[model samples]
Every structure is written in C-alpha cells, then in structure tokens.
Target: MAAPTFTDAVVKAMKTLYPPELADSAWDNTGLLLDQALLPEGTESKQSEGAVLLTNDLTAAVVDEALEKQVNIIVSYHPVIFRALKSLSNQDPMQKHLLRLIAARVAVYCPHTAVDAARGGLNDWLCDIILSETKEAERKVVQPISRPLPESLQGLGYGRTMKLQGPMPLTTILKNLSRGLGDQQHIVLKDADAELIVTGEMDHHSALRYTQLGQTVVTVFHSNSERQYLTQVLKPELEQMLSQSSRAEGRVLVSQADRDPFETIDISSLGS
Candidate 1:
C-alpha cells in the first residue's frame, strides 16, 4: 500500500471534522478542489508531504506564500473556483492564480460551508465570540441542515441565534464584537429573527428591512467573519487531527496574506 500523502491526511482530517455532507452543496464547492497527489498532465510526482497552509481564500498572494513556505496543501476557507468555469486562462486573476498553483503542485482544499454548518465549527465559534461577554445564553441553530447526516452531527447548522441571559446593553455586545473579531478599525457591529442577526454580510436594503422589523443586523464583511476561525479553531483542530492521523509529522501554518477585501476608511483624516 502507498504511504498516505500529506494532501490525503489533510483531506481526511477536514472531512472527518467538517464532513462535506454538512455543507450547503447547492451553492458551495467544498472538499478537495485540487490534488497534487493526482499528478499533473506531463510531469512525474514530486514530494507528497510538506507543511499545511490555512487561508480564508486562495489568491495569487496566498499561492506565493504557499510556494515560499513549500506547503503541500492549503486549507482555504473559501473556494477559488466558485463559479462554473468554461476554461482556465491567465487573463483572469483567479484563473491565473489557479494555473500558478497547479504549476507549483500545491494542492488546495476548501471546506467552506461545511465549516460553517458543522457542530463546533465556524458558526459556533462566531457565536462564542459574539456572546463571550455574557455569562450564559441560549444558542439555537438558525437553519438546521436540510440534508441528513449521522447522529454525531444531529444539530449542525450554518448560523446561530442566541438569547442573552439578561438584557445586557448593546454597547457591551458591540465592545465584545470588536474585541472578539480583532476588528479594531470598525466599531459597526450590529443583526437576526431570533432577536439579533450576525453574518458576514447583508445587503443594505435587507439590513434596513431587518432593522425596521426590530431585528439587529451585524455584518463583519464576509471573509473577515470567517478568517479568525481559521486561526483560532481550524488551525488547532487540524493540528490535533493531523497528529492523530499520523501523516508522519508536518507543520500547519495560517497564511499571513489572507484578509477580507473590504475595509472601512477614515477619509476625514485626509483633511489634516
């Protein structure tokens, strides 16, 4: 039998922890999206084991970081190949990055919504962050899985809603949000049907609609909402799972380049 490659180990650990079945497959393209172990068109296979790099997205910069670090696999939280592609071409930046990744034989895997929907996954972690100020709260799934899974994942869902123990001031919640997400620059934490809604994003009109209905909406700016979980939760979990799976020994590192694209600027400072 062939030795388990590093890519194989990472995939196994991801699937075991965040089963693809838990993902919202209708729109999400999760699991091993790239496999260096499969070998490219004309070249012989290179070393199949190296370090793991975790990132929220697989951009060209992240790819460069992966190559510099000589990682065998990247556990990106978002899929680079999100839309249906007719072909790969350098003219498009993301496609160019894909080609580059392929050339370097750096495999890519994404657990996107699986991580969100899995019990104790990103959504749960987000809840912990949002409610960390409270002594206790009742957290319930905002959307339970439509697809069935084993009993082990009975309550897995994509988002969480919490009923605070006591009527804590919203200012305290805002302070906790800023502290928890490490979003020092933005103080605009504010969302759900269950009382408040916290998400990576919400369109302006939708946010207005919810607010009009007396529900608070908090938008952490998509990738920003997901990035910290990769560092705090996924990194440690992958490390533990990798150690258990015995892929021999390899380092699991988070990418420094990965970040949310949107930033709120203080343009008034320009007047100075």
Candidate 2:
C-alpha cells in the first residue's frame, strides 16, 4: 500500500492516539519527532527510514547514527532542543548535535512529560506489565509502585506501592522493570530474591542494599524509563496514516527514524 505522507502520519498519530488528557498539564508541546519542514514534503529520504530513534538526550553519536542510517526524522521522547536557541555555534554538546541535525536535514520531535504522564504512560505502563505477569499469583496487584512509609511515618516517601503479586524471581522482576522502563537507569532490586518492597522513588541506599542482597534495583529517570509509548501509541498512529494514504494515493511510503541515545547497560556488573 502507498504510505501516508510523513506530515499526515505524524499529525494523525499525535491527535488521535495521544489525546490531550493523556498529556500532563505542565507539558506544553507534544507531537512530531521533529518538525516537518526538515524533511521532504511528507516523505522522509530512503536513508532515513525504519527504526525510530528514542532518547532524552540528542548526542553526537545518536545524531551520527541517524545520519549513517540516512534517517530524516527523529522521534525523540525528550526534546534535544528545548526552550529557545539564540545561536547555533556548536559550543555546547546539545548545540553541536543540533548543528549536525540541521546539516543532515534530520527531523526531531519530542513528546516529553506529556508521554510520561499520559494515562497509559510510563507509570501505568510499568504497572500493567507487572500486574500482567502476576495475574495468577497469590498476591493482589496494587496498581502502581508505592514508596514504603518512613520507618516511623505512616506513609512511604512518594506514597507509591508495588502491585506485583506472588513471589516473582528477583532477576525476573527486575528484568521486566528494566525492559519496560527501557533500561535507562541502574536499579538494584534488593534482597527481593524472596521478598517484595515498593517505594515512591528509587533511593541510592535502598538500591545499593538490593545489590548487596544479590539483587539489582534502581529507578530510572521519568524520561528514559518509559519508551514503549512510541510503539503502543506513536507507531500505530503512523501505520494508520500509511493505511489512509494508500487508499487515497497510489502509495504513501511513510517510515520512522531511530534517535534514542543511551548506551547499553551491562546489568551483570551494573555497579562495579
């Protein structure tokens, strides 16, 4: 089928799949991995097709990868260029990245906190994964990760709680968490070998302790952690555009670009 134009694909995806309610009130901008003008009218070049790049930071290596792949658009979760830019002197790393982006004619877009805070965003995405695995477990799913109440206080730090049921292998659970969160942060899943503990956010001491107990638990940044939204919400929207475009024209070949920027983590020796 003829793919939809990139603009149509991006616009439709953002408007239909990511409703405003899904985004946080504070997040002002959300949609398009990058501006449309950067690429061919509605069509990304062949060099910049397939594999959408996802990342909070748009680093040199990341941009280089896009160039090598001939990707014209970057569907970044975090905006590489936030606020206003007075100059593009390439003085800063970000600026350097931007310079490269413009030179390569790569399109970059960020969904930011809107995607994070969305109803099916990071938090809920994590919760759903955990709950799905423990669907048949003895314990009940709580809903979200809750921080443990202070030793003496009545509530946990963030009031977040774990919703995992049954005795999941520490390794298994942590793997799921890391995968669901896109392995952005290093967390030590504590003596969670045979125990379960929930917290509002990850603490260094707690994370360290988890490692000491032969477990790994670490809380990743809100940005790096939840990336599946692209596939769950963004990609589908892109596909739909292609479907519509095919019906309208001979074929609208629309594709995405890869732009994530975190290096792979060797979880086996995460802290060492």
Candidate 3:
C-alpha cells in the first residue's frame, strides 16, 4: 500500500492508544498538529520535505534539530507546549521553537499522557518486553522488565492494576525488576507470609504489612519504573515505520535510532 499520509499515520497511532469515544476530557490534545495546508512541502531553514521527527523530550535543542532537518511534522512523546497560552512571544524557547516551525510551515504535534496509558502504548509494551525471552548459547531465558519512560508516560501514560501472569519466584522477579529499572535503591523488599506482589512506587504501610506477613513484596520507585517506555516502545515503533517507509521507497534512507536516551548504561561498556 502507498505509505499512509503523515497525518493519517499519526491519527492511527493516536487511535491505537485512545479511541475518541473512550478518552477522558483531559486527553483533548491527543491529535494532529496544524492543518495540512499550512505545512510546507519540505522543511527549509531547519525544514525538510515535511519529514516527521519523533522524540521523548521536545526540548529547544530537539526543536532546533527538527528545524535543521526541515521536518514538517514533529511527533513528540512529550507535549512541547503546555499550560494556557497567554501569548506567543519569541523570547521563550518553546515559543521560539513554535514560531520557527510556524515560519517554516512545520506542524508540531504531541501525543502525551494519553498514549502512555493506552493498551499497546507504554505499559503493555513494557509488559511484553519483560515477558520475552533472551537467547544465550541457543538457550532462551526470560529477562527482567522495567517500567516505561517519562515521554511515553506523558505521551501515552499508564494506570496500575495488581494482576500478573507467570510462575517465577517473587524474589527473583524483584531482583530482575531492579536490574531492569537501572538499579535504583528505592525498591524495597517486604516479607508477606503468603502471596507476593510488586508495586511500582513505595508505600510504607504496605511494605510494613507485607513484611509482617512474610510475603516477598517489593516496591519500585515511581520514576525508575516508568523511565524506559520511550526507548522500549516508541523507538521500536518508529523504527518499524521508518523501515517500512524505506523499503517501499527502494532506499536505505530512514533507519532505527542507535541509542535510547534513558538507558544511562552503554552497551559498549559491557564488553569492556
């Protein structure tokens, strides 16, 4: 099929997360950027043939990159523009970025918190990654899982529920989760006598109760548990999109990003 129009792809991605009918009132910003007519054919002066730039943080530097690349559509996981707009002064960074995009006929779109909580957005993807098996010497083993990232949360966001599937021991699961979450010390282990449970953020009362009960309960720091969603979910999705685009165009133009910003650890460091 002809590559879906940029706007259409974006709309499809959003609908994947939030059905217009099911979304809450707060998710009003989960849609396209400015109209198609205002967008330029290719970005100029930090513009392109209307390419779309996607990222977790919509910082000034990122905006500059988008302009430099002449991107027509910017699909940021985080909303670059927030708060009520009192006015649009060129002095502010975001305003400057907005002005630059507008001047270049680029349209910036953000798919914040709404996307995170979506079914296949952040949480669901993370859950799948954790459950996936890693291969070693032809043997496959399950890997530990981590929570999604700030951008994914802002873009898609998530809610928590207690049900889980798997037969791994609770202690092993907690350790693996810690590894996945960047080894933050915030995770606490409790001993509840019967069933074990894991919570993303720490709760003292719950910890104490679990400890008293002898259940092996663990709590994850809120920030750590949710920081990798962008790397884990959005990046892969974009890669797939870019890959398909490249194949259809008969060129190796668009490609997957080499690194994820949230994983402070370098893959190169492992061999050393």
Q: Which candidate should be chosen as best, given TM-score against the real structure?
A: 1
Candidate 2: stretches off by over 4 Å: 1-4, 25-29, 32-34, 38-56, 136-186, 189-224, 227-272
Q: 184-251, model 3: which lDDT tens digit per residue?
A: 54456665546654545445765665567666665564434444555555555654654454222211
Clashes of each: 9, 38, 35
> TM-score for model 1?
0.85
Candidate 1 vs candidate 3: which has greater lDDT?
1
Of the candidates numbered 1 and 3, which has the greater TM-score value? 1
RMSD of each: 5.3, 7.7, 8.2
Clashing pairs in 1: 190-217, 190-218, 191-196, 191-197, 191-216, 191-217, 191-218, 192-196, 192-197
In model 3, the runs with Cα more than 4 Å from the true position are 1-8, 16-23, 33-47, 129-157, 162-171, 178-227, 238-272
Where model 1 places Cα greater than 4 Å from the true spot, the runs are: 37-48, 136-157, 189-194
Every candidate's lDDT: 0.75, 0.52, 0.52
Per-model TM-score versus the true fold: 0.85, 0.57, 0.57
Tens-digit per-residue lDDT, 123-189, candidate 1: 7777677667665323332222223422332332366555544465666666777787775556444
Worst 10 residues of 3 by lDDT: 249-258
